[model samples]
Every structure is written in structure tokens, then in C-alpha cells.
Target: MHNAINESYLGERYSEWSLDSDSTIETPNKNQAPWGLENISPIFRAYENSIWQNHVAAMWSHLEARYNITSNDSCGTHVHISLIEGYSLSALKRICQSIIYFEPAFEAILPRARLGNEYARSNWLDNPNFGYKRLSRRESMVVIEKCTSVRELVLLTPTTISSLGGISSISLKPLKEPLNFVVVQQARLSAMSLYKISKIPATVGGLKWFIEAAQLPQQPGLFDTRYINLLLDSVGPKLTREPKPMGKLSPDKLRKLQTKKDEDKRKNVMLAKISQPPYWG
Candidate 1:
């Protein structure tokens, strides 16, 4: 199948979506409110819009109850983008190389506090000077996977990652979601794991997949249940849930402000170190 880049699609590194309990919004939108995952501590799912949407709130509430989520389950958003015919493996490699070429820009922007600790600290690389480059390696992992006879690139990791890390975390497969690393609930984790797998019937929404194997054993009333196992549901997109772009800051303005903030922080830290005395007086 021929695939091309949808100009509308954005390649951006967005901020961590804040989860507010007393959110007055009624619906979920793309920018005013975008959905994100935060299963770790303070386990609560917040709405992404000024108004709450039908499916999102109810669905997340159901999940929260069934899964005993805790603070430890917290995870940073690791977006995965599928590379189709237009964006083949070779294209991804070029992107990776570009990031490596502009490694300083990445290091200049990403705060040090976000790196080197434990949870998400440090890229696959450990050194601050070069470790930042690892961030670009994540996207390099995107590769083509064939399910049945269909073939496509399954992108589950960032366009950049550490040198050692492979496809970031989730184990990509044709029939199922990547192997889940976030343990929302130990006992119920097995069931939650199915959410990411393409084999299960998609429930919530976003983009999803459905199998049409005419050859699979069909159970027409009299026959037993064989196709039931094949039923799978993945998340798909909902226009109603997205926020309108009526009121928003310009992207260029936002980038400039964010850059200044980050740069100022780095500058202050450097000056402080130079002025402060050594521990051994």
C-alpha cells in the first residue's frame, strides 16, 4: 500500500499533561486538552478539554476502579508513531542522524533534573555530554512488522533513544500490543496488557485495527467460539473529544518562551556552581 505524510500530523515533543481532579472542562481536545498516561503515584486521570467527553471520563474511571493503580505506576509519555510507506525505515534513520547532529540543541532544552536519577533519568546513554544524543536513538528502532500478510512499520518508541535500548521498551509484535512494562495492578496487569495488543477488540478510541480473516474458523450459531479470541479493540480518534483551536497561543511564541525558560535555568545553575565554594574549606 502507498503511504504519504499527512502534513496535518505534527512531530512535536509536548509537555506532560497535567491531571487535575477538579477539572471544570467538559470535553477532551487536541491542544487545549490532550490525553496522557500517568499511572504512577497520585493515580488519577484528568480530562483534556474544557468540557468532559463521553467516552474518556467514563472509560478511565472504569479502568481506575478495576486496576489498583498507585503512585509507583507513573510514567512519562513515550509517543510511538507508525512509519508507513512514505516514512520508511530509511527515512527514520535519517531523522536519527539529524538529531545526533544537533545533539546540543536537545541537551540545551531538556532539563538535567529529568535525567540521571532513576525513573526516567538519563537517556540510554549515561553521560550528559553525549547521553543526550541517545534521546534521538528511540525513533531509530521503528521497523516493519508483518502480521499475517500485511506489512507496516510499528513505531512504539521515540525517534531517539539510548544506544543500548532497543525499540525503547514495549516489545512490538504483529498480533498484540507491545509487552507492557507499566504495572498498573499486579493481579489485573495480565488483562490490562491486552489493551495495547492489536489482537484484542478495541474499546476506547484513537486509531485501531480489526482482523478480517475469512479463513478463520467461523462460528455461525452452531459452531463453537473460535473467532471470539480474535476479537480485539484499540483506541481510535474522536473529533468531538478534541478541543477547538479558537483560543491558543502561537506555536512560535510558546517555543520561544519555553526555550528562554530552559536556557535561563541552565545559565543560573552554571553561575551558581562557579560562585559557590568547595565542600572542603
Candidate 2:
């Protein structure tokens, strides 16, 4: 599968390289990706929102070192946003409404065929469940609790992800704090659209795993350092929860911060002194 991808279509690999996988899917309860070697298809699968965008960037560093990126029907991103507790399907519906409302911007960036594939069929998206009719929090939860799995998420068209697993996945937003899941999902949809880079031509010798990746255009610079950093900086905040600021430090605490910086500098200098020269250069 890897060798079959066209280098011409995907672009070129332009950086130092090594194979190190950092991609993480913290969403809990996702049908455990076939773990045994039998079902184990060699493919890079990552699920990260804005909070952990840096992990995505870091993972890119490893991939760009090897293959170009290909964004096609088979290789698209599915955003799994965690919902706040006591949330209603209405919240999710509003998000669907927004996606349908602002379809043009997203349409321009996504591959034409992706909108109709099994994973993201446009016809299925036209369901009445995700319509403007608001489901009460109780009503929504009832439907949600009865199901489990991304497949069941089909009912919530445009917003394809149903529910996932994690404390980060499990931790619900504070009840009283007003949060707009629509805004969050809309933001995620926009980010996904931007990242849906469609084609690349490339060549390689061997192929194994994720046959679908070979079906369309490839992304050569998918792991470009500059591109990765830019992507993370742009959307990292939106995806992750903001950490509360440890209130202002006392004079003693300020001194400790200074001490910490000094310790870090000393350790870094020592490490550099012991390090070997660059291998690739």
C-alpha cells in the first residue's frame, strides 16, 4: 500500500528521518482498533482536538521523515469532541445546523468524493435526527445512552462522531458554565476542512497496510515541521481545555521560578555538551 502511492502526486519528503509514532487516540471506548496482528493494518491513526495539537505536530515530524500525506476519501479526519454532561442532542444538532449552514466554506476544501463515501455519506447526513427540532437534555441522553460505537453516530449526520472514551474524554464541562458545543464543533469542522489536503504524487518500493490510503491523492508534506507547527499554533487552544492559571506567586515563588529556569539551562547545556553531532546533516 505504501509503495503504490505516487510520489509525483503526493509531493517530496524534505527533512531528516526516523520512525517514531507519537499519534494518540485518547478517546476512550472507541472500538478497540483491531489489536491482534490479524486485524492489525499498518496505518497511522490519530484523534486529537486543539488541546493536543502539538502531539499531532510532533507525530508529523516522524511521518514527514517517511511518507507524504494523502488526504482522500479513505484518509479523512473524524473529529471526536467530548461533550459536557447533562448535554442535550439539541446542542449537537445546533452544531449540525451550523455545518449545514456554512457548507460552502467547508465544501471548497474537502475532496468532492469524500462527502459521499461510506464513512461520510452525504445522503445519510440528510437524516431528520440532526434537524432543527431540539431534543431535550433528557431526550437526547436517552438516545445517546442506548448506543455505542462510531457507526451508531450515523444518526447525527454532519456531526459524525457520536461519543468516545477518556477522562479528558470522560470529564464533562462544568454544568453552570455556558458552553456552545456548536461553536466548538464548528471550529473543529473548519479545522478538519483546512487540513483535508487532497492530493500528492509519490513513489516508494514496498507497500503494507491501510490499502485505502493508496486510493487517492497523497500528502507529501503532511509532516513538514513548519506546517505542523503552524497547524498546532493555529488551533491547539480550541481543542484542549485551558489550564487554570496558578495564581500570582509570592516573592518566594518568583524566586523558585527563576531557580527552575536556571536549572533547566544548566541541564540543557550539559546535555548538549554530551550530545553527538547531527547524523543527517
Candidate 3:
């Protein structure tokens, strides 16, 4: 059951990348390169939001083709490479790394919660239900302790943990001070979105593994499926077959571009007004 759950999670991860990549190609003008300064445009309202947008763009660009090539699915969802037989270990590691890098703000919130626990602090500990097996009690405790506060810890822990083994029981102790409800809510929402975006690249990485594992012939499958599709779907029909050499923009064309930019700015301002967060006293 535990393995199955993990597999399901990985599959979802892949699916997210698939969707994100599809969205990017379908919205190329909005799909700026990862870490690109263009993210500061009015379309992305905040730094974190911009980061999430770009991460999704990058991730989708990475994974789309790989999965399409393998064309494998577990259940109804596309079978992410991480869930493919024999691909879990490395896939898990890569997924972890991507989460850390692209979602640092969310990552920053976890260690704060773990510091309040006693059992989590101890050096020597046993999984009592598992017959006293040595556990990474200290390491786990350290991770928790390093968290800045309780809110951070809550954000870090998985939403659910299911045991495939014998009966599992756990206890929770109240924090000295509960996390700020509003802040917690915002952080949770942002973290959830970030997690969603990070899944794209990880899914692509997983698909790459699957292709290799299956000993399929190397070709343009990865780019052809994910990136090209994204570009075609989003950017509309390819306007030209041959690459045109760069040329200076004529004054008339430049003026038209500037006008479009100004219009975009006005539209964004209006949208922002409509979507402004509610205020309360």
C-alpha cells in the first residue's frame, strides 16, 4: 500500500508537468524562460508568483516530450517515469532536489515547526511499533529543529502518511504559540502551487529514465512531444518554415509594438484593481 501510494504521488507529479508544459506551449508569450527578468512584467503580480510561473514554464518544457514518447500510463493518468518499474530511487532523488531549488520559500517554512518536539529531539530512539529498529531519530529531529517556527514545520510535513506495515500510531503536542492563521493560509496556498509547478521537470526527468530503461531508440521524441507541442498549441500555427535573419525594427513597427505594450500595461492595471485582495480591520 505504501509503495502504491508513492507510485500514485509520482504519477500525479508527472501529470502536473504534462499539464504545465501543455499550458506553456499554449501560452508562449506568457511562458518566459525560468528566472527570466521578463517575469517582472505586470502579468506576474509578485516575486513568488513570478517564480512559480517560470518554474512551471521550465518544468513543462522539460517533461512533455519524454512522457509522450513512452506513452505509458498507470491507471488512467500518464505513468511518470518516477513510477515506472525500476526507476523510483533516482527519480525520487531528482524530485527532491527540484523541490528544494524551485520552491525555496516553501522549503524555508518547515524546520520552524519541528523544534517543539521531545521525541523528535532525542538521539537514540526506536520505532516501537517496528520492534525497536534503529531509526534516523536524530537526523529527523535535527531537520525539525532547524525549522524557523511551527508554521514552517506544518508546511513541510506530508499531508498524510499511510503505513503498509503493522499498526502505526503517533502523537502530536501543541506548539508554544500557534502559527498565525492568515499567514499560514497564504503560505499553504503558495506552497501548494509551488509544489504543483515543480512536478513538471521532475516528471520529465522520470520519463527520460523510462525511455532509457525500455531501451528505446534515441530520437527527437522528448522535444517533439512536449516542447514542440507546447509551442505549436500555444503560439498558433508555425508562421514560417525557415529561420529569418534578425533585422532592426522599422520605426513604424517599433511604435506599434510600444503601443501594444502600453495596452497590455493598462489591461493589467485594470485586472489588478478587480482582483485586489480584500481588506479587513
Best by lDDT: 2
Model 2, 1-281: lDDT tens per residue? 12211112122222222222111212233445321110011222222222233434554565558754333223324333333252354444333333333332233333444432223322112234522344532344345445554345445442333322111121221122212222334232232221131121111101111112223223232212333222223332223221112234568656654664454343322133223232211
Candidate 1 lDDT, 1-281, residue by residue in tens:
01111112122211112222211112345344333222111112221221112233444566667754332122222322221223444443433333332232223322333232222222224323233343322232222111122122222223233322222322122112211121111111122112233233222221111112212222232112222222212212221111111123368545644664454344322233233332211
Question: Residue 99 in candidate 3 has what lDDT?
Answer: 30
For candidate 2, what is the lDDT? 0.29
The CA lDDT at 25 in model 3 is: 13
The Cα RMSD in angstroms, rounded to one decimal, for candidate 2 relative to the true structure is 22.0
Consecutive 10-residue window with the lowest summed lDDT within model 1? 180-189
Instruction: Report the lDDT of model 1 for residue 200.
Output: 33
> Candidate 1: TM-score?
0.23
Candidate 2: where is the Cα deviation over 4 Å?
A: 1-51, 66-73, 84-86, 123-125, 128-281
- lDDT, candidate 1, equals 0.27
Selected candidate, larger TM-score, 1 vs 2: 2
On the 0 to 100 scale, the lDDT of residue 165 in model 3 is: 8
Give the 10-residue window scoring lowest on summed lDDT in candidate 2. 200-209
Error of 1 at 188 (Å): 37
Worst 10 residues of 3 by lDDT: 72-81
Q: Quantify all predictions' global Cα lDDT against the true fold.
A: 0.27, 0.29, 0.26
